[model samples]
Target chain A: MRIKELFINNFRNYKSLHIKPKENLNIFIGDNAQGKTNILEAICFLLQGRSFRTSHEKEIINFDSEQSKLKTELKAYNQNYSIDISLSRTKPKIIKINNSTTSKPELATNFGTIVFTPDQLSIIKGSPKERRRFLDLELASFYPQYKYYFVNYQKVLLQRNNLLKELKEKKQADTFDLLELWDNQLISYGAKILMARMEILKKLIPMAQQIHNQITSDKEKLTIRYRSSLNLNSNFREELIYDQFREVILKNRQQDYLKGQTTVGPHRDDLVFLINNKNITDFGSQGQQRTIILTLKFAIINLWSCELNDVPVLLLDDVFFELDSKRQKYIFDLLNKDVQVFITSTGMANTEKNLINIKKNAIFNVRSGLVCEEEL
Target chain B: MRIKELFINNFRNYKSLHIKPKENLNIFIGDNAQGKTNILEAICFLLQGRSFRTSHEKEIINFDSEQSKLKTELKAYNQNYSIDISLSRTKPKIIKINNSTTSKPELATNFGTIVFTPDQLSIIKGSPKERRRFLDLELASFYPQYKYYFVNYQKVLLQRNNLLKELKEKKQADTFDLLELWDNQLISYGAKILMARMEILKKLIPMAQQIHNQITSDKEKLTIRYRSSLNLNSNFREELIYDQFREVILKNRQQDYLKGQTTVGPHRDDLVFLINNKNITDFGSQGQQRTIILTLKFAIINLWSCELNDVPVLLLDDVFFELDSKRQKYIFDLLNKDVQVFITSTGMANTEKNLINIKKNAIFNVRSGLVCEEEL
Candidate 1:
């Protein structure tokens, strides 16, 4: 999948901008705060129908603006498509694909992307929430319906947490009765997430390990372990996992009551990275951690491509500058010819000479919220 | 000040390692999980007598080892010093400076180092707790006494928060009277922290702004505002701020009762970034966010230098690879010649030539928990 063109108005710092990106590689370069990342954010918003930067959609609107608009033309699965989206402060965002209104998950199912930002390093270094999201995102690309259950699970978890907090304060003896209802709802949705995540990891491990070995020249081995709160010894089964979850929740009820929050569940799960049988968090150096995360990216891209006939567009946001030249070249060599990549960097003069055969790539300079394509 | 030598035994992945560092630039090069950061962690441990990676000291002990030891020989304030630290599984860490036992904070006042790591970006892009810690770390350096006050403040805050939870759960009227006592203790300590943070920001802002302008070549402006929960308009007087805090806490008592968490305090504070008067969190690009964080690092270095006659050694743990050449250059040029810099990277063959002026720098290779100095 590739975004051929993008149009934006009153989104973030941009007043208005139109960009035509090449099918192979497009690099946006500029000084700091000159709007290099805004282009990538625009592309991400187009593909995901949302901004990863913030949860508040209204925040995307330009200052003193009532709404924002984004339009993109892309080719995916050997078919061309157009998407129009309007983000408003007073109303819900309106999204239309091919001139017909469509759900975000539906749009993502047909046209999708894989993104890596410098910030995305958090998956290897951040909280459990980030790790869980990493797995869920990989699962969601293959099973778009998995996102539906995943989001619903998150919502139910929050609702359950809020109820627990309130019930604890109220000191209701029968709070368990109400919690049982929330628990049932939580498990119903959570079980799908657990199953999908388990299945996806089984598929991703060998691929990630292979890529990891190549990156390290086989000096170290990489392995990713899904740390489910249920602590199951065997592979997932919906009924069996559901019962295990309920039992665990019951055992933690007293502690949960004290904290006024759910103490156990998928929400508290994490991913563990190991190299040569040693856990990365306790033992890996910075290079090892970054390499492991990079393998995860390749694993995700491979998984997404296997699931869809079209290769997913790759978005690299301010991450190219962070990698060493060897790792940078590894990324380039790893990218499939059919994959379209958009990269943002503060400067890329040194890098530009080494990408896209050193000639056939789109380069744009962004300044003060405006973008201008440079002649090849 | 510069470190002359470092010796580590049974720390993290390392069984033992010894290093002699250059006074100008010492770069540790290795693949991931090869103990590059363990070297920095050992330096940080010898100086600060604690691990920045984890609070639990036993975790730093090499697996199956009973203890970990870190020793450093450094020069500070025109005097040579030797520091030794040992972490054991069942006892508190022991620290000795120049053959005499010393408290960590007291030793830090005489021999200190500033560190920047990829993980430190949390100061700009992480939780409120991280932001608060950023402020407190800076404050503690200038006024080691400030740490005493800050620790007391945290203790009182936790006590007060716990009291709020208990009060809400029990629903007793007399609990209000007990709450008053906790509130007074909370106010006393909170005011000091609030005042210290405000004063430090006043010192830090102009320096950060100047560096931000230089980094951007005057293409943008950067400003920081300390957004305290107290929301004060002027520099603090303990009594005046305490009164205000008491009133605010009283006003939020109902909401606090509902949530069972204290809603007003330094714990809830955050620092806001602005570029050209636009909130950076909402408007800054990825480059801009990183630049702002980089400015904060420079500003901190400056403040620490000004407070002490000795130039603080700098420990860069896998951060150089993430910075662009321009940024990497800016940081190197900004460092005083007297300052010693320790850098860790996975690959630096290309960077080392440019960074060492093609001569006169120390390079070390780390592999499988061992360190070896490379010939020039």
Candidate 2:
């Protein structure tokens, strides 16, 4: 997959911007807060139908403008695609793909993107919510149906919690039957989410381990495990998982009612990273934690290539400076010749010197919301 | 401050190691999990009498050994001092200063040290607890009396919380008097903690802002505000803070009883970093967050120099590679030539190429818990 051209107006710090990026490597270089990351955020928004930087859509729009516009021309699977997106302060986002209105999930299925930013370090050092988010976001990116199940699970979980709160406030015992209805729906959706997560992890963990070995020269071993809220016993059967979920929900209802929240579901799941049987977050050095994240991302890229017969557009945001030249070389070597890569940096580091194929690179200088492509 | 000699025995992967570091610059190079960070942790242990990497002291002992020992000979404030520490899996730590037994807090006041690890990024991206810890640790490092108040505050908070739980379980209104006794102690110590934190931030924030400007070339302004659980005005009077703390605690006791936990105090305080009036954690990019942390560390170094008339020994672990040459130069320029610095990296980066003072540098190759010093 490659982005041939990008257009932006009234988005973030970019008032108006357009460029035809290189086929293989597009490097945006500038000092901090000079509108470098905004370019990557724009590309991510076009592909994912939402900004990855902020949850509030209105924040993406320029302060002087009521709405923001983004358009992209890309080639994927030897096919051309044009995705247009518009954001308004008070209205819903309007997305059009190839001149036809489309939903966010529809747009997501048509394009694949993997973004790596420094904030993503949160996956290792942050709360369980961050790890759960990593699982859901990656699963949704690869399998659209997984998004549906995830969304429904969240909805059922919210409804069930609200009912629990209402029952607690009113001191009602008759509402137990109503709670059971939400539980069944929760179990049905939660089971699918769990199964999908397990299936994906089964494939991802091994690739991550192999890539980690390569990155670290086999000095250490990496392993990832899915920790579900329910007591799963190496059983991948959906029916068994559903039974376990239902039984756990039944047993914990009283506590849930007392606490006024749903306690067991995919919402409570977490991913744990281990190196040589030691939990990385608790025991791994900062360098080891960083290596694990990079390993997982590269593994995802490899998985996308083998399973989909295509690769996602790679967005590397100001992370090159953090990696040594050897690790940087390893990353470039891992890339397929045709994979399109976009990188943001301060232009003062040796990242440019580490480029494996300089002939296929496009350099852009960004400053104060203005961008100009440089002659390479 | 300079370290003349370091001796380690059965620490982490190192069965035994010893070295005489350079006066100005000492860089330890190694790959992942090769005991590079263990060196820094050892120095921190000598000064702070605790392992910065883990709460469990047993983890620092080598697997084949039952205990670990560290000794450091250093010069600070025109005075030479030797500190020795030993850790055993089954017993308490033994700390000696100049061949005399001393407590951890006493050791902390005798020698100043500042450590910057990638894990310290938690100060910005982690929970309120992390921010509170940053405040407490810095204050405790500078003022040994602050450590006294902090420890007493924690003891009172724990006792108050336990009493709240007991009152809830027993349904006893008569225990309110007992709870009040704990509350009085909580407010007394919490007010001192609050006043100490406010005083430090008042000095640290301005220095951080100035240093941030230099790092970013005046493009961004950094501000750090202490957010207390108590409603505090501009007054710095301890009595004023105590009154506010008492009022808030009194009002929260009912809710605390219901939740069986203490809710309002210094334990819940937080530090917010803002770049140009925007929360850095929520709105700043990864580069910005990284720069802010570096700025704060530099500011702390500045504060130590101005107030203490002597700078702390600097320990930077694997963070130079993350910074560009320009920022790295800014850091080295900010340092006084007499300051001793210890750095750890993979030796594969351009960090060696950015050394400002080659003649003053001592390079060490670390692998499999062995250390070899190279003549520069």
Candidate 3:
């Protein structure tokens, strides 16, 4: 979807701001710490109901103000939509669509946005937790059922852990019955999650490979494999899962008692990245690793487009300046076709000229916290 | 930031997909599990060099393939920018900007984006670890310096914890000199982080209150108090911190040995949210708690905008459908202005008329890993 207009009041450095986006290309140029990124962030906030920057909603308010409001008008699928959010200092923030208040799930159903930020490189260099989060989020957004199952799985996981702790503390035998009940719930949800994740991976692998070939010029072949303690080769019925873990759980009872924690199940599952039949984490160069990540992202985009039937809005914040000319040109040539884009740069000079040549383009100069349109 | 064009190959569902976004608004609409959110996630992956949906890059590839690629051409800040990512089933994900390979930091500098999702609500409802993570991610994105400091702090924390573990195992005297050195590093980096957080919080409090007031119709006030065990009330100098923790560390030395972990410092700090002078976690309705989170998100958007001088992209995945109509309308009205927006919904019937009225909108239909543009 594309954003038609945005209004910010007491948000960041904009005491009161209003802007209309160009249909094809909108650019924000400013010096460091200017309000360039803020404009983009406001859009993201309006779409997602949270900031890409900080977790605390209070931070968005202007320094002297006790609240902030973000408003946006969007045109998608031959439709018009509005979103409003108000931030306060003494109570909870309120969100409304059109003019009605809503909950997160409902809000999610109404607005869907994707963002590209620099920190995403962590998917490669960071820990497994980060990677898992990526999968969970993507799945949650596309499949509401995933969200429900995921949330339920987590709840069960937490409750199970707590029960394990209690069982240990009380040194009780009867608690096994309670544990069984929780385990059944966990398996029901966990198995569903596991199946869904596996299915998604199955669907994503081939597409990722072709993109990897293009990015690497066929220099390398990459592979992704899901590794779970529970064998996927066998029947994954609830009874099977319980049977597999029963002995292990009983044997680890003493350890669980001592540690006050649960030690097995999907929580411990990991995804393995292999390059040329070897683990990339253990052997790949930094450059190679980065390329692998890039390919994966591209593959995701392709998959998303194919699955969703729409090209998502691209938000590029200061990323262009970091790439070499050849790669930059490839990207430019590709995006030159038909996509609405918003980009933030330290300065306009840092960008490529092809972008300026686009017919439908709007450029804005951002300083401190104010934005003004610039003539091409 | 707005997306101009997107191309994906073998990432998740699309073996090969290409689409151009509308200049102003684009919508990915489909039934659950159709990959609408995946499109947004792919964009986020390109910008961040990571996926917002999954943690593992390998998982992004189609299941039958070995790798994936995501390419996006962005008209940002009046410039053309391209980002390409490659993910392999057997290797690390790779990234390129404008076709030239680059590092994570370089990618981050070039592409900046902000995203908001339904999961963010957990920042308020979840444990303190989640909240701390929210803070860290924001700080790391806007201020690269904080990233270094955070890394260093983590290193020191790890080392100190290891030393504690070793001492306990060997039952040796405390390594006072080594401890002192680690403490110095920890205090230095921790102090900087705490200081920056405090400064940001100082600005966020007022804004959150005001927004909360508006959301609650002046029925409640929201407050965020940073509750640190580090004696933030006093001068946070290294000397003072050392003095304050000296006795406690010394006395707890043996106990720490038994526990095998460091028991004190900023790592143990918590962020407490208060509503109407009462702790929300301790006493607040589910709705109140949700509003607190919503307000916090808005506040974060404002804070990031003000601090970084750029508005980050908003990623809203199914949050709109979760709220009441009043709140939904508020968000819809807000979105009516200027911010570039990307939204995903099961259908348009639930959205505001204004959003439905825009003509320069791209709408896609997603189903079972297949996408088709809707005839407008």
Candidate 4:
């Protein structure tokens, strides 16, 4: 996949900007807060139908303007496509693919992006919530239906929790049957989500371990295990998982009734990282934690290409300079002809020496929302 | 403050290591997953009587050993002192200052250290929990009694919550009286904590704003506001704050009883960051968020020096390379003769050019749990 042209209007510091990016590498260089990262955020919003930085879509619109607009022209699977998205302060965001109205999952399935930002360092050291988010994002990118299942699961979970609260307050018998209905819906949706997650992890863990070993020169081994609230078995069919989910929900009803919240489900699942049979969060050094995250990125890139038969566009936001020369070289080695990468950096001098060997690349100077493409 | 010598035994991948650091700067260079960060963690543990990376002290012990030991010889206020700490698998950590048994707050008051790690980017983006932690750590470093107040506040809040649970379950008249007693204790401790936080914010906010302006070249203004659970007035005497806290507790008892938990206290307070009067967490770009955190760090360093009449040692863990040359220069400017600094990096070539102007600096090569001092 490649983003050949990007257009933005009234989007985060960018009043009106358009650029023709390189096929392989597009690097945006500027000082701090000079609108370099805003460009990437715009691309991410277009690809994912949401801004990675802020949950409030209205924040992406410029202060003086009432709405923000973004357009991306890309080639994926040897076919041309364009994604157009518009956001307003008081209205819902409108996403159009090839000039027709579309949904978020459709846009994501048509265009895949892998983004790495400094804030994402949480996936390594943060709470279980962060780890679950990382896994869900990865799953949603490749499997569009997973998003539907996830959304339904959350909706059912919310309704179920509210019903629980009502039952605790009113002690109504009819509410108990409604609880059973919501539970079945929750279990069905959750089982699909869990099965998809377990299947993806089955493929992702080994790839991450392999990359981690190569990155560490075979000095370390990385392991990622899914810590589900239910007792999961090796046989991970949807029906079996749904049965296990039902068993747990039945077992947890008394506790859930007391707490007035859904206590066990995919919502409570977590992923744990281990190195050499030790939990990295408690045992590994900071550098080790960083390397594990980096390794996961490589593994995701490889897995996406292997399963989809097309590469995902990579977005690197101020992370290239943070890597050492050896690890940077490993990343560069993976930037083959098929991978289109967009990188935002505060300065180019620190990484220019490493970019000398890349044949197809372009540099753009971003200053106060104005983007000017420069010749190499 | 300057650390003349640092020694570690059986700590995080290091069987034993010792180094004589320079008075101005000490840099440890290594590849990923090496022992560079461990050295800094050891220094932080010695200065603060706790590890900055992990809550589990036993994890610091090397896999082959049963305990970890650290010693630091330093000079502060033109006087020499040594801190010794030992952590065992099944026993509490022991702290000794100048060969006399000491406590954590006492050690922190005598030896102050400011640490910046990549994981701390969460201070700007993660959650209210991270922001409160940033404030509490800063307060505890300078004012030892703040730690005591914070500990007591947490203790009272927990007990108060337990009583609320009991009242919900049993509804005994005796339990209601006990809740009132706990509420009084909670308000007293909570007021001291809230007052201290407000006072510190009054001092720290302006300093952070000044530094943020300078770092951004006057392009942006920074504002920090304390968002306490209580509606506080500007007259921040402990007595007034305590009265307000008590009123709120009284007003919230009904809701607390229904929910079976304490509803309001310092434990629920939060800090909000604004760049140019807009909430940074909601509206700022990633670079803007990162720069705000960097600004807060420089502000804390300045505030500590101004209040204590002595500088604290600064520890940078894999964060230098993440900054551009201009922001890097801002950091270099703060490294005067009085401020001792320790930095860990993955490679020398990326930052070697920046280090050319510093005459009082030392570099060490760290590889696979071993460290060797190298001439700059």
- Give the per-residue lDDT digits (tens) of candidate 4, residues A103-197: 98778777778888877778977789999899998887667798889999999999999999989878663446678899999999999999999
Cα interface RMSD of each candidate:
3.7, 3.2, 19.9, 2.4
Clashing pairs in 1: A285-B33, A288-B32
Model 2 over residues A1-376: C-alpha lDDT tens digits? 8898999999888889999988777888776677899999999999988777788888789878999999999988779999999899889999999999999878888787888887788899889999999888898766779988988888888899999999998898566998978988999999999888888888899999888887776878888888888888785789989899899999998899899998888888889888888888877776677778878887888888888888888888876545544566666666636678888876634553556465777778887889888764
Q: By DockQ, highest first, what's the ranking? A: 4, 1, 2, 3
- CA displacement after TM-score superposition, residue A304 of candidate 3 (Å): 3.9
Off by over 4 Å in 1: A13-17, A61-68, A88-92, A151-190, A231-265, A347-352, A358-376, B9-18, B29-34, B56-68, B87-92, B162-178, B231-236, B246-262, B324-327, B346-376
Q: What ranges in model 4 sit over 4 Å off?
A: A152-190, A229-231, A238-268, A348-352, B155-187, B228-231, B239-265, B348-359
Where is the poorest 10-residue window by lDDT in model 3 chain B? B348-357
DockQ of every candidate: 0.43, 0.28, 0.02, 0.49
Compute the lDDT of residue B365 as modeled in candidate 1: 86
TM-score of predicted structure 4, chain A:
0.87
Compare candidates 1 and 4 on lDDT and give the better one.
4
Model 1 reproduced share of reference interface contacts: 0.50
Residue-wise C-alpha lDDT for candidate 3, range B287-361, written one tens digit per residue? 455567666666766776576554445555644433434455555554444345566755544334345535566
TM-score for chain B in model 2: 0.88
Over the stretch B164-186, how does candidate 4's per-residue lDDT look in tens digits?
A: 88778776534466687888888
Where's the lowest-lDDT run of ten residues in candidate 2 chain B? B347-356
Docking category of candidate 4: medium
